[model samples]
Target: MTTHDPIPARLAALRTTPTPELKQQWRELFDSEPPPFNRRFLESRLAYRIQELVYGGLKPETIRRLERLGEELDGGDRKKSRIRADLKPIVGTRLIREWQGVEQLVTVTQDGFEWQGRPYQSLSAIARAITGTRWNGWVFFGLKNHRRTA
Candidate 1:
């Protein structure tokens, strides 16, 4: 049951195979219907599942060590570590936007955002103040984009 070649070959083949063939491979390997995810998701998960079968999954101790490394890199605090690294703006970074023909500037401080020499808790607040309406700060400043529809 520990065949390495066909598993990787199948995983690789998944990239070029049509959806029906991918589902067939899913049935053969997992003995269940594949989730209705896109081709990339199916291929990546199936590749990992194939590898998991051929070589046993990661050891618990190894997983713990990796988690510890991640925590250490993310400022050693669990709360900070929980924040997505991409979402955090580096200290001293300046954000600028134009609203109503006026340019607004915000500076990223160690604790929060500084706008017009005033400390604010969240970007949405700044966006609301600038636009005189409710707006998602991240979206307004382009930190985050709206999710794409399938």
Candidate 2:
């Protein structure tokens, strides 16, 4: 015996499928609309992931602001969410690499990814091309600035 339900109800029921199937479905859902919200979420997730990898003592204020922004957005506040819209790496994440070496020194705070000794124009530009890969990793290996440097 088959029972028919309203279209909305049927669609909602079919939407979830199951956990395993939901994985692919979820991918499609994100891929279809990887925009401001999704991009921010992904970037936040990537930031946290990279933080875990490097174990750098990121600025507490920075972390707090990011968390607050994410929370506000997840709560459905589009305005606040838009503030974090710039987080997404449109191309991909990059590591600060030296101009002539495989080793990455660390990013300089001048708005570009820094490598061994030279700074790149931007993360996306450095990566050249982007893939759906969760950001590779990052190191807090910043330059040592003496009082004189400042």
Candidate 3:
């Protein structure tokens, strides 16, 4: 059997300005959503609250206090968000738009060609392939590569 405890000690350590009635307020809020927070949408609720806390001129202090409590909390670390579709495919692959503004793909950054911004780590692998003269289009084109080294 498992037992759960009310988050008192953790909340006590984060007492920024006393709101004695705050527990009542929290209880009322919990009464409304008794399922408890365990989803991305639930977390996003606290995200807005935390963002406001940071913007309210308590970012550093909040970070410190939260770090203390986070050491005890299980799911304290935030998850990384996924980039949009446009940036998603291009994360590890270098693509380009031709005169028709279509994305033309290339296997390697060929000689005498110039690139403005860095694509991704795939750039390093492609560069290494080109320099090492082991350039293979079949290996790179539309291939999901996992290199233990690189």
Candidate 2 C-alpha lDDT tens digits along 17-119: 5544444433554444333343334444444433444455568999999888777655756654565455433333443544345454344343455544565
- The models' CA-based lDDT, in order, is 0.85, 0.45, 0.41
As for candidate 2, its clashing pairs are 96-114, 96-115, 97-115, 97-116, 98-115, 98-116
| Residue-level lDDT tens digits of model 3 in 66-125 | 777764542443431222233224323454334234344443332212234433344334
In model 3, the Cα lDDT at residue 98 comes to: 40
* TM-score to native of every candidate shown: 0.62, 0.20, 0.18
Residue-pair clashes per prediction, in order, are 0, 6, 0
Model 1 segments beyond 4 Å from truth? 1-4, 20-37, 73-93, 107-114, 117-121, 143-150
**Higher TM-score: candidate 1 or 2?**
1
Task: Please give the ranking of all candidate structures by TM-score, highest first, separated by commas.
Answer: 1, 2, 3
Residue 115: error of model 1 in Å?
Answer: 3.1
TM-score of 1: 0.62
Pick out the ten consecutive residues of candidate 3 with the lowest summed lDDT: 79-88
Say which prediction, candidate 1 or candidate 3, comes out ahead on TM-score: 1
The top-ranked prediction according to TM-score is 1
Show model 3 residue runs off by greater than 4 Å.
Answer: 1-4, 8-39, 44-90, 95-103, 106-150
